[model samples]
Target: MSPRSCWIGSALAVVALAGCNNVSNEMVKMPPPAVTVAQPVEREIVHQLEFTGNTRATEAVDVRARVNGYLQKIDFEDGADVQAGDVLFVIEPAPFEAALDAAKAAQQKAEATLALANADLARTQPLVQRGASTEQELDVKKADVATAAADVASAKAALTQAELNLSYTQVKSPISGRVSRHMVDIGNLVQAEQTTLTRVEAFDPIHAYFAISESDVVELMAKSPGTSAASLKANPPTIYVGLTGEKGYPHEGKLDFAEAGIDPQSGTQMRRGIFPNADKLLVPGMFVRVRLPVGSPAPGLMVPDRAIGMDQSGEYVLVVNEKDTVERRSVKLGLRVNGMRVVNEGLEVGEWIVINGLQRARPGAPVKPERTTEIVEAKQLDASNDPAIANSGAQLSTTTPAKASATGGN
Candidate 1:
């Protein structure tokens, strides 16, 4: 019980207490693991194909001068809408008029010579018949008459040609359409069938040319009969065209032509749609989107686009198995419908997928599942909702009212 013994005992007790504290700190409890959640979703997805196409006019005609002359006047304004047979240009008619007059004068001279020959033949015919003239004299007279008749016929042909040349001075439009800028100014000498006066394009029933892959054609034809282009007229597919910035479909069209053969380089088939452009909104060479419904709708698996993630590898989605374990799955995607993606492979219907909190989830980790907010019926989701569907469903709900109410109404 001395002071040194008491200090040593106090030091040992302090060391033992410190050691126990260190052991307790080393054995501290661990925190709980993070959990991810999966969602059971139902959405209608569409498989669509997109292609780039160009707008074209159904019929484009170039206006050219058929006769040689100076352009006297342009009857139609540049870019003005015109009808077929409308006069477009007028060449200087003075030259053509002069030629026509010369032809007419020649025709009159030929007619005078023909009249003289006929008179002479009448005078000699009776003499030869009454034996008052030699046979050689009658033959000579006949020859003279035939030669005069030939000259008259030649003059008549020349006159007709001259008249036709005169009419060519006034050029007219070949098709009903908007005319392009005048290629020749006034007093510009134009040649016969050589100069391009202007251009005219038919706007209504415009053409939309688009290409589809051969595979797409085969798939489409599998569903429809008369696969050949010649036979497609009976039941051709409808086409829809939309401008670059337009929201809704502006024009509806019909499939007018399909190429007889596929393009060797692109392995695609060229098809044209005829759109009724009464307003002339669609023009040639304008870029547009051409939509053609090629096949029927079918049931397909889909997942929310938000669930899809992309990295160095490609597109992937997080899937939750029945054990509530998350797994990263690589998926092949089709078209996008609503906000969901059509799954071509790598996933099945009725499987749980992780849509929300994808960044926080990892593969092989346990998660808690919750239902998604948006759920669309399988059959209700098509290219677009058909109003007939709602009508049919409502028709099924129609029934007789209560018996008392029915009797009172009657």
Candidate 2:
């Protein structure tokens, strides 16, 4: 081979190396992923706390026999409404009547003896003054009159007691409420205050008892300055309640009682709400869901519920920073209101939250964010439809501010 051919080969190899270097230095750049972002919706919303509880009768009484006698008649039907002083049972009155008659005869006899003794005393007074009768004899007559008078008084007292016993034969209801079935049948011997005849319970104005966690109580007190267990008596917050198989909290009541302190073992405090149960829907021992508004209405931020993401760290949202970079933010959530989740904490009102195209965004990655206004429509909150409550199998119920206000509260 010639020297010229070798030099040309070397030059071609250098040119090829220079071309490969130039090609590697040039880079292919791709545009950032596109995502839809929206600012948090600000609205006037009332924060609500929910709890589970049980219903109890406002007043419950166990009717018992007051006198020892054989039951002659049950005046009221089983499970009937009874008024105060209504005759519920009739004991055998024949014995009481005979005793009363005997007492009356004894009283009459005592009175006749006292009248005769008084006449003797009157006659003896004059004899004693005239010395016709011995002073000792007059004194004996006076002492006999006093003893007869005491016997008359004792007989009168016995007669009064007999009358009371006769009246007790007719057992009357002590309160106006629904009456339970008669436990003792007719001809059954009932003892005084020993046998339970039946049970009567007042259904209207039922009570709901629940426990509030200590942390929740503290949060409530912080939100409302004067709210405390003691203050509940003076300024009772309105309570909304719903029974099992019910939708939202349809029944409304007021906080009636609260324990003086929280229970250390359970970290909760006992609370009671009194609800009007005119329809008799609330029954004793019925499980119920309670919703209590913690504070007055205030401005709050909300986002679409779908925008929330969950991981081991808890619920979070994808945020697009001012530099158009994706960022992950951990957030605390509240009740679902108007198809949106309340941002209890960790999200600012002005911050942009990723509402759509979440898959296209990654933390610390550049993103092409498109600003959009989220449309939030207010609607009736249904317990069965909310996944947050339904999936957890919690008895807690929630309501929107509008529904809460329309239901009316104290």
Candidate 3:
């Protein structure tokens, strides 16, 4: 019985030892995990401050009736483009015409009186010298001439005023722009200097206004030494603008104006940009996206966003060395430009970064890194979802420069 038991135990121990040897051989023969790696892309990137703004016409005018009269005719259709001096409304010009004719007649009569006064003065002067007329009579004639001359001048001034009033009857646009609908319909009486006829707004070369925070302004000033609000206005920086539903900032402009001081209540400074609206794409009272580059373009390194990972130590990336060893690198990241994450520090250009199979990579362990030449195309930065910009709270909107009056007639 003892011999049988010992033999059975010996056979079991041998089987266990053989199983352990097989497991060890399998572990040693297993290959390293394959991972996709790419070198960090170097690009020229500019840090831009973004904001929401509103567009307004460069020149806006509220056209009004200068003379009191009934609106006889509307020469333009609603929302028509008009040039300066284009007749928009005829405000009972017939009455003004009659008044002008009467003034012309009065002016002619005054001129005749003036001519007669001069003839009389000439005749009296000769008579006074020849002693044909007494001194007192000559003086009386001179007084009569002076009085007639004054009356003629008064009549002439009246004539000029009448002509001006007549011209005012034909309401003309004072600026070249798109006109709003007429405020007063035909046969409606409009008061002089009080009636708002319509509005005209210049579209080409439009204005876009946005507000920037005082903190951001201070940062900008620090970046550019010796730069002040006045200097910014005098030598404007390039700006980009985009309307709602538009991709990127297609319109280019200049930061033409900046407020002298930041508003204490809002802690922001008003800034204005002027853009060419030759295509008529930009309209007043439209919400737009604006971008202003902070400093000159600088070189930066970027990697795919998926390649980055966060931990208790903050953001880190899996980098592969020349020996195919994986290393965990703590990196300082900036804004996301395009779709790539900007590596501000702790990463170098041309260093291989794990793009795929990150979970399979372990620090200080060997990996089969598959090198990839693919890179993200460096283009315009979309700051809409950038956490850096969102944290700064730079996206803000302000009131439009000019509001169209609802009561004005087009």
Candidate 4:
């Protein structure tokens, strides 16, 4: 009886131990962590290149005195709008008037001398023909007449020069534009073609200059050969200029010119646009942003910033597979518009991605997805939802576990 009882008890104990081990293993096996997944969304995307540039007036001019004299009057007010040929200053004309009078008197005296010489020549010709005067006398009288005619021509030229000088006494603007402050005020002596009296800047149809990368120029030219630098003057590209802190483009401009060669130092091509500043709002040396349409818009895919993850390798996003499992996906990015990113590759539309609870998520782990809006509501309901974590999770921050998983998965 004792041998039979001992054997049965040992066998039962061994079976029970084996059963307990199986139960322990079963209890330790836990399901994958719950994660929310999202689908790759489809939307229209626009590719754009944003660059910082400056505004400049298309043309600028400086007004100066052509003749030297004391400025008797200022015809234009400082900072006043003026037209081409508008009087800007008036120099003292007294000296110029005296010169004109002297030139006219000299001209009249020369004319009188020419008339007397002609009379003498005529009289000598008759005498020579009648044999009353020597041929040498006739020749001398004819020479006198020719000299008098030359004197008359010289006097006439002097008179014309005097008139021109007199006209120059009233300094007129060379171009239509806004007149700057007078460099030389009234009663100040200015030199001829040497001293700059003031400046006149053309505001209407002003110019804006900007630079584009050499690569961009090459791409653009490849797409449209007609838009090369050589043909820019005849058929220039259109440009739009917008001021900082302003809404839309205030002025539309046309490409006027481009540099013949790329700038070696910057590796950029300089381009110019002409804009109409009829309102006088645009000025030279003003900083402005320029927009140029280089290519046609194409349809593409995009995702929110929260879905992208970045690490040493590059940018990527989390993709939920058909089995409702998370898989890290490496992506090629194109442009950033608003807060969204253009997905150049590595993602297809309508694929789910984990957007929330990413801090606790890992690659290939099972996820329990809640709508993004639901997550927001839950965070609002539970004050303990650490807004920072919720926001980070919402944004799929790279430092978070889900982002690490994406990086690891990649």
Candidate 5:
């Protein structure tokens, strides 16, 4: 090797060694992650299950024509409230009146004939006993009397039928309710037992029908052993109902009816609830929200839904320990009351849980946690989450019982 090149390489190695010695290994401390935390709320809570249902009338009646006649008059206004036995329509009474009169005349004639025949039989009996008439003649006279008596009875029945037809000419509301519009106008020919003049539905008490899944039914039956859907029909459970667009269940009702069995097509069992609608606020066929209590009141712990998290292990929540270190806790969950998810296990009532900035939390890491009495501040879905699932269950339920409803029975 050339002496100049060896000297240059040696100089470069000495410089690199000096640079390496000058550098020192040191670790920079990163700041603890800032987060919000809250203690869980403990309360005696029962599972409130809500289901979509439809309102029904307690008693719905289709006022139909009872006798064939021309509609003569409409006595009640369309959609007016009516009492039981209130006249709503008037068919032409002329024909029925004439028929009834004819029947009465025929009955009178039969009565006169029966009286004459009775006198003749009395005379024949005396004559037969005294041998003033032949036995065959007396027998013939007795038969005549019997025939006349039968005619009189038949005529009386005809008269009663005629009177009934005349009475039916004035059609009356058979139920107390708001009447529907007239189906047939004045002078329209209506057939007996064939035409529906209008309809009436009882309004004081309304009904709501709903369905529940088989799993829910099983859970409910387990909580109250020996309870069956049929037994519930006899003595209903407490329930609540709400109309569409209502914020919460505003109407109270009772669960009175349940289908004999579950519907195979939908895997749900039909149930019914009855609500007092004295104010006439409820209508038939309206969609309603029904809420039912699945379990008796028991102590339970709840946390903000946002604080709950999921991982390969299962659902978890970040809890802050005494040292304010973030700890991942696996928890068993119950039904959501609203925004709050009930923690059945793995969480204590007083434990601090991370309510916000979950991304910043990691197990065993120290964190800057701000504690507040308000456990779950109502929160919306974050933008980074998948849109489809991001909006799902974002808000936490405020502290309240879950709303529910069901059907009604007699």
Candidate 6:
């Protein structure tokens, strides 16, 4: 081949190889990695402190016979609900009835004597006016009438006492509550206010008693003050409560009472929460958990818990910006609510956080952003539109509180 022709052919060959390499490079190039991102949502959150407590009854009464008598009948079932004034025990009324009859007889005798005195006084008044009877005799007649009148009054008082004793024979419950087992059985002699027949405890609108440390009280006083404020008795702070076997504080109550001062020995102020027990689930002496707000509810930024990452430094989350680059943000986390975590510091509302595909997302790497909110809205729509799924979801777990209120002591 001629020299010029050979050089031209080599150049053409090099150009062909470069074109192949260019095609290979074009085929190998990839689009940015797809990632799901969500903005930090604003929610109302209250900072809270948790304390352990136990349930208590608002009122308890011990039932006893008010009149001395032999117990004739037990009227209520042991460990059963009883209303106020319900008959709990029936003491024998025969003795009381006899006493009442004797009193009535005595009153009748007094009345007959009084009537006789009045007749005599009437006769003496005419005689004295006519000067036929002496004044001294008339004075003695008046004195006798007065004595008889006093006797009638005494008899009437005795009758009232006897009636009261008779009524006391029917033992009644003092308050509406559940009665305990009988302490005194039928056929036993029961003394008035001495022998206890049974005991009862009020159930609904139960109370939970807990204690807050002196430091906690001081902190609360400076912040919300609650019932610990200057007007302590009138305004009580709000509280959340949960019993054993509960997921969280499903019950809300108010701080009803606080000790006048902190206990010297324990350095804690005894506090009580009054909760409406409409379901009758809470009973006396039950152990409970309570959450008291340290501060008022305020708007805060929140994100899904899965988006949070932990390392040697602290908790952090990956945010995808408008430039499509991932950025690691160190976050000061507060409490967990629902399935989200509150970012107390270092995160701004509307910042796009990578919710899924965390493995593929790296700091400073570009990502193809997918709006997680859209996905959630779509899921919610599906839940509302599909009757079968809606029914099934209704059968799913009931709506639970998004946040956990209890915490370890500081």
Off by over 4 Å in 3: 1-39, 126-134, 225-228, 232-235, 305-336, 345-371, 376-410
lDDT of each: 0.72, 0.80, 0.80, 0.72, 0.80, 0.79
Error of 2 at 12 (Å): 36
Q: Largest lDDT belongs to which candidate?
A: 2
lDDT of 5 at 257: 76
TM-score of 4: 0.72
lDDT of 2 by residue, 128-189 (tens): 79889998998899899999999999999999999999999998998888898989999999
> Between prediction 4 and prediction 5, which has the larger TM-score?
5
lDDT score at residue 13, model 6, on the 0-100 scale: 99
Residues 111-136, candidate 5: write the lDDT tens digits: 99999998998888888898889999
Which candidate, 1 or 2, has the higher lDDT? Answer: 2
Q: Cα RMSD for candidate 3?
A: 14.1
Local error of candidate 3 at residue 45 (angstroms): 1.7
Model 1's alpha-carbon lDDT is 0.72
Report the lDDT tens digits of candidate 4 across residue range 173-257. Answer: 9888888898987877889988898988886787778888988888778765555778877777666777877644546778778
| Candidate 1 TM-score versus the reference | 0.78
lDDT of 6 by residue, 364-387 (tens): 987777764543532342243221
- C-alpha TM-scores of all predictions: 0.78, 0.73, 0.72, 0.72, 0.76, 0.66
Which parts of model 4 have CA positions greater than 4 angstroms off?
1-51, 247-250, 304-341, 352-410
Off by over 4 Å in 6: 1-44, 229-236, 299-410
